[model samples]
Target: MRPNLLKRAHSHNKQTLNNLLHSRGTSPHPQPETISGHKQIEEETLPKYNPDHWYPVRLGEVLHHRYEIVVKLGFGMTATVWLARDLQADGNAGNRKYVTVKINVNTLGEEFQKGRREIAQKLFSANPKHPGYSHVRFMLDTFKVKGKHGDHLCIVYDVLREPIDLCMEKFPGRRFSCPKLRILLPALLQGLDYMHSECHVVHTDLKADNIMMGLGDPNILDHFVQNQIDHPAPRKAPDGHGRVIYTSCSDFGEPPNEAVIASAKITDIGLAAWGDEKNTKPIQSNAFMAPEVILQAGWSYPADIWNLGVMLWDLFEHFGLFDRIDTKPGHYHPEQHLGLMIALMGPPPKDFLKRCAKASIYFDSDGQFKHPEYIEDHTFESSIVRLKGEEKEMFIDFAKKMIAWVPEERWTAKQLLEHPFLTKEKEFFSATPSLSRASTASISSMIPSRAVTPGIPPSSSPNSGPNSSPKSVPNTTLLPPRLLELVPSVSSTECESSTNCEETKTEKLATNNEKSTSRTSLSLRPKMESLVESNNEPDVEVPNSKRLSVNKANKCSQDIIDAILSKGKNHNHRVSPEAK
Candidate 1:
């Protein structure tokens, strides 16, 4: 253990504080029987899987001693994953700290090294001091696994016991409340920005199941194992359905139904680029591919926006817009993807579709999709998902901008960042360096200092309702446009009202940005009944004053007996704390 970390632990219970500050969602625990490896685990398991429970992977096993593997938190194509602990770890670490580790000397030979590099790059990017600030990024601590097969890189990270996807899965039909969803979006966006903007990387596999949350550091000797229960991978096609399902849309019979604002971080990258695009690898991009990417038209950053836009659409409608549609077939050529474009959207603009250069998209007379000859055996079906009201209008707008058949027409990250919906969320949930010693020390210093500018400027306007406005906010594109509507007015928010207030506040107060599940149900809230009512203002009641119009201010006190109420209550909640 680092000397400083040990010294700091003596003064501050950093471990407890770390647990309290984590931002993970609580997924339901499996039944005792199932957990113990003795029940019919749900279809969430895989073909080569154990249905009963979760297990952990610990790299520090031989390096240290006495630890055991507990559960498997996540898995990628290259390696198995586990959450582990060492009974004899240094300091109080033996008590059970969540640690994640990946065994490298498994499948996928060369790609393994690339994944290792990605982890290394991701760790560097995750550092606040690093040029690429990532929220969903992973950390890599190298370890050796010496078996008959030899050794390799084992990635390690803080463990996230519960994943948000499983949490949503347990709830089944209930959509996340606006505040709850907002809390997660910022981190997901920052994560995406890291992969896209800083790394020049594309996460071909962006989905709810891929994104994870973790707690603390995992040294080499932690308890670890692997259990194939509650598979977090994308769901597959059933016999009759015949189509692989990437997005889940559980319909709970209710009006104003909310969807799981899916937790998104790109995963399963480079599969599309690793091999011959013409040969078609066994791995697939599935429904997330944009038309430009599908057609292989010199794609770039906007391709990610296209995928994100589609992901948002799936969240709202419960299915992939282009899923089941055989956009491309016959040797997995990019040109065949045009079939998907025409199906999801009516048809691209002639100029846009004309970029096909290689294949025929239409007849000379109509410029319509005529000979879409790719799908022969399999009938193409548009997931023809429906959208309503504001969602419909907003989604279509974003879809047009993102899913343009032509790559050039797609919206850039800079443009999406400024969209009104996103701008509002960005403004409200403005992330500031929360755990800086300088800021804390300054606050504790006795000397007077210049007025500080708040990270997200507090609202000082009369129109301080739900979404006050999108002006004055930069980096707005961190959220999907439709979801941005609920970004609370940053100034007026309190722990009591704004659901996202907690996440935003913590991201401000601490850059560590732990995911926590603290929610208040209105029905269970304690009413302010004034228990000491005996001495309260009553009996000699003053004459009722006119209701304070929102347009005016009203302030009065006992100091002025003849004080007249002329102004309205301060609509803006930016109050300065008074001197003691």
Candidate 2:
């Protein structure tokens, strides 16, 4: 019932259809007071309201003499979702269970309704033993409500908290943090595998919006219903309209934790189709359409993979993968989209062009884009700047396997499960230097095993040994920014206490801090010189590959030492007392 909750719900509820050619109307209209004396506020588009279009419902109204409407959750073009309590359930007001009731528009064709029912039946009949079975959401119950214009089909579902995108907004950049991404990707892939392999369903629409974050505590819904009863939702009777438009309240209780995030499920299968079928009607949101979908060629499960690829970019980068608009605003065209694809991945292959039914429209005889001017100079390497080193490499490799020009080239959901990016047991680090156990493992993997020995002094150092040079420490750009920020400034008093006045040893400390969720430790030792010398051991011969690996580790370790020295230099601390 909070204003921000209502605003976020309003933005999410009014889901629009993004396709090839259609656009919705958003003409300004006058705001007047409702019969309840409240200001006329908009929920869904007022123009969309009609007897045959959007079905009208009132708050506190009991549908089917069982489910009591509690609050509006969200609305799409075809249906409006509401939070309702099943009267048949056992508990009292504070303990009763709640379900989401999706009231379909009266105008949703009979075929659309039938398709949903069939998919639900198939999903229920499918194998439940699969790990992904629980990750994908299905209908709990289905019923009907006769309206003034026509009978509205109502489907019941387990109440989910909110969309994944809204949940990701809690992080720093309105994107999923590395830790959350690790939890999200595998679950999504499993769900996709189950939907494709077991259920034979292709979720044509796969995006952040379609994925709903699952509820953690069962009591959250009960709390929500109790709050609604205590503080009734905003009701507005439109001027001369017969029904009151209740503003949707989507907040379940509090912000979700890691468990709630991990429980996220793939939802909204209205556009889902059987993978075995060759039904080739254009599928997927315009920005996420696969090459096959855009070319008007036949598509199947692989198209979903392509959709996932684009959706990943949106999730991580906080932007769409392509620019679909032409010179005019709100005008999205396939030509422009294809042009951008060319810029990113180069022109479609000759074999791929031959397979496209509409290839001639966008591509020349030699498979070049017809509108070269529309192609922006962009590449995957240039776009993904948030990640670096192994993380960036693995991500790009994982994404390239899915966003291939040819649908067949895209890896299947099951195959993608084993991708190094997903399967690699790497724990993503945060902006903070307080490394988790998982973070330690990830960093250890980055450093070569032979190159590092914790708590042990190096045999010799290239700089500090018997033969050493008195040169200023080189620049330190290699250390990660987060790690570099932790380097303490070397004060003159602190330097005076050092055993070796020529060099400052990065003090190592271990603390049993119960306040942090994970272990907080920072070890910045200048052991890179010893690592370099060890690699050049005269009697011990090593492989060229091993040498390269050790050199890489040396460089990485050297960065930390340089960063520590640089901090000392900036503070004007003397490396040794030999010179004033």
Off by over 4 Å in 2: 1-43, 46-51, 92-96, 239-241, 323-330, 427-580
Off by over 4 Å in 1: 1-67, 74-76, 86-96, 104-107, 110-115, 126-134, 149-152, 161-163, 172-174, 177-179, 214-284, 326-340, 349-367, 371-388, 423-580
Report the number of clashing residue pairs per model: 36, 0
Best by TM-score: 2
CA lDDT, candidate 1, residue 489: 26
Top candidate on lDDT is 2
Query: How far is 127's C-alpha from truth in model 1 (Å)?
Result: 6.7
TM-score of 1: 0.49
User: Model 1 — which ten-residue stretch has the worst lDDT?
Assistant: 1-10
Give the per-residue lDDT digits (tens) of candidate 1, residues 1-580: 0001011111122235534354134335221111211221222333443211222233234432433455434444344555556444455563235455665433336665776475456535544652225345455355555444345456566554334444444433433333333334444556655655455555555655555443222432232222222332222222222312121211121222122223233333323231112321222355666664443344454555667666653443455565545534343444355565565455555554454443253434356556567333321112312322222222244444455555444444444433322322222222111212222222112111111111111242212334534343223232322222222223323423432233323233211122111111111111111011111111121211111222321232222111111111212221112101
Per-residue lDDT, model 1, residue 27, is 36
Please provide, for model 2 over 1-580, each residue's C-alpha lDDT reduced to its tens digit, 9 standing for 90 to 100: 1123333122212323531123223423222222242334433454454635556787668998899887888777677788888888877544336788999877877888898889888887789999788889988888899877788999999888778777676655677644466568777888898888788888899988889777777667767766766665655543344656666667665666767877779998888998877656888877888888989777888888888888887788756677445423257678878878887777777877897899999888988788988788777666665654335545665677678776655556765665535533222111112322233223333322221111112332212233322222121122334433333333334434432222223442222121122111101111111000011111211111211232343443444344345554444222121110
Q: Residue 179, candidate 2: how far off, in angstroms? A: 1.8
User: TM-scores of the models, in the given order?
Assistant: 0.49, 0.67
